[model samples]
Target: MAFNGKYELESQENFEQLMKALGLSDEVIKKYKDLGNIVEFVQNGNSFQTSYNYGSKVITNEFTIGQESEFVLFTGHRVKAFAKLEGENKLVITMEGMMAAMELSGDKMIETLTNGEITVKKIRKKI
Candidate 1:
């Protein structure tokens, strides 16, 4: 699978703004703003296990494509989400009021998370 690998955060845009829009406190944002993230994905057919490591915090979610499952967000909020594959290289997850789309391109994984008009984009290089 194209997504089965560990990726290190290369850069991010609007991270603090998006986190604030997501209701994160200034203290919490300051604690994690400069910390890099490592995301690992394990794919097996239609099922996938994804883990996002943010130094002191790690959030993991396991789900099958096109199925509704509970997922823990970076804010430590649990929500029901549905994930689906868009084409061959893009995976999109839809939550209650947010959407996350991750696309694999060569050795890079580009993730975009949108909640209303606020969006955060992170680029990760496979490591």
Candidate 2:
């Protein structure tokens, strides 16, 4: 799959606001605000395993397409999310009041997370 790769954060938008909305503390946000995160993905047919490596912390989740599974958010909040494929290289996950879309093109993956009116966009390059 196009999403099966290790990626490093290149840039992000409205990260601080999203962190605050997710109930993260100012100290925690400050600690990660300027740091780049590494994300890795492994896929096999309809099953996927994704790992978000944030320096000292790493959150990993395994789920199948079109199924509800437990997903751990960046804030350490766990929720039941459903994963669906929009196109060949795009995956959309919906949970609670938030939606995350991950689209892969060339060597970059653009991930957008939306909670109500607040949206955070993270662009990562395959490494």
Candidate 3:
């Protein structure tokens, strides 16, 4: 699950496709991309850091994910963000519970969702 290499256009497209497949509208896709590059770090004691990039502006924050209540919590300098997946739905839980459905195309879906740099034409699903 480690992200290797630089971000590429193809990788971005893959990520976009993952979002679309996950039932995210064009608006949501735009906003997620606009949210910029997200870097996640896991540390001691169920604590984690998620750094988000907004163009030239970068915001680094910390929080805990998968430690409480099916939510990914992020606390930043000026704002807090959280996300979650419930059933077929994905949500920005902390921000007024904005939700969308999850769509699974393949492992490329995960690469896209994480904004990974690899361009995978097909991904195998494990049953």
Off by over 4 Å in 2: none
In terms of lDDT, which candidate is strongest? 1
How far residue 92's Cα lies from its native spot in candidate 1, in Å, is 0.2
Checking candidate 2 for backbone clashes, the offending pairs are none
Tell me the lDDT of model 1 at 38.
86
lDDT of each: 0.90, 0.89, 0.38
Each model's TM-score?
0.93, 0.92, 0.33
Comparing 2 and 3 by lDDT, which wins? 2
Query: Which number leads on TM-score?
Result: 1
Count clashing residue pairs in model 1: 0
Q: Over 4 Å off in model 3, which ranges?
A: 1-13, 38-42, 55-66, 69-127
TM-score of the candidate numbered 2? 0.92
Clashes of each: 0, 0, 2
Q: What is the model-wide C-alpha lDDT for candidate 3? A: 0.38
Q: Write the per-residue lDDT of candidate 2 for residues 80-104, one digit (tens) a residue.
A: 9999988789999999988999999
Q: Per-residue lDDT of 46-127 in model 3, one digit per residue for the tens? A: 4444444555665555545443333332212143345443343121224322332222333222332332333323221312
